[model samples]
Target: MSRSSRVVFYSLSRKFVQEKQAPPKAQEVIYYSLAIGHHLGVIDCLQSRLECPLDGFNRWVAQLPSGGAARRKLEGLGRFGEICIDSTHTHLLATALSKAAPLLTDEQQSWSQRLIDLLQLIENEPAIYLMVRRRDG
Candidate 1:
């Protein structure tokens, strides 16, 4: 992603935090797609240390408006997508998650920490890996 892309993402995340309203469907799709892509990357990077199940990941993905299609795309990947999310992006996401944590239901809160941890891990690591799925004919 370019510098501008990062700025756009950070700006969008900050907006999400401040407004406490869901972005439009298009923005939501982009936001969650990038967020989940980065998350899956973090999980893959820390595979030995983490135990993120696909079912759980899918559940989170299902939160998106187009979640069913997103989950199908993820399933097609057959493995982690390789993408990178910088610390700035990760930090913004972490902040957003933390601020929203208190409002989450018990079940949602259970996995929230895992999400926070992954975001924090990206900060410590020199580089964070994220993935984008590709389709082959």
Candidate 2:
């Protein structure tokens, strides 16, 4: 992603947090999509350290924004999608994800870090690997 794209994303994230009233559904969706994509990068990083198959990665991508325009623009660098769909190029993906971590809020930061910690756990824990699913369909 170019500097301009990162600027736009940061603007959107900050706008969502500063809104006086409830954000429009589209804005809400954008925030969560970006947040999930950012954190998934972190999980990809942890996967490489363990050298385990990230079988659940694709399942996460399937839940993200799938519209061609939205998918293409939001994922200009193909951060989360590439990591989820293809496992070989994960090191690059992890570096991209770590950069995005600081853009998240305190709550979002904690939630995302939890996923990172879970991936680092020595014992295999199914609960830790579970992805968050929104109820709206």
Predicted candidate 1 versus true structure: per-residue lDDT over 1-137, tens digit per residue: 22221100011121122234545775666555545553422122222223334444445445433434333433443454322345655655455556656656566565557656666766676355333332222
- Cα lDDT tens digits, model 2, 1-137, are 22222111100102123335545765656555534654422122122221111222222223334553323332432344222212222233333334546555554444335434433331232222222211111
How far off is residue 52 in model 2, in Å? 27
**Every candidate's CA RMSD:** 17.2, 17.5
Report lDDT (CA) for all predictions. Answer: 0.43, 0.32
* Candidate 1 RMSD to the real structure: 17.2
Q: lDDT for model 1, please.
A: 0.43
The 10 consecutive residues of candidate 2 with the worst lDDT sum are 6-15
Candidate 2 differs from the real structure by a C-alpha RMSD in angstroms, to one decimal, of 17.5
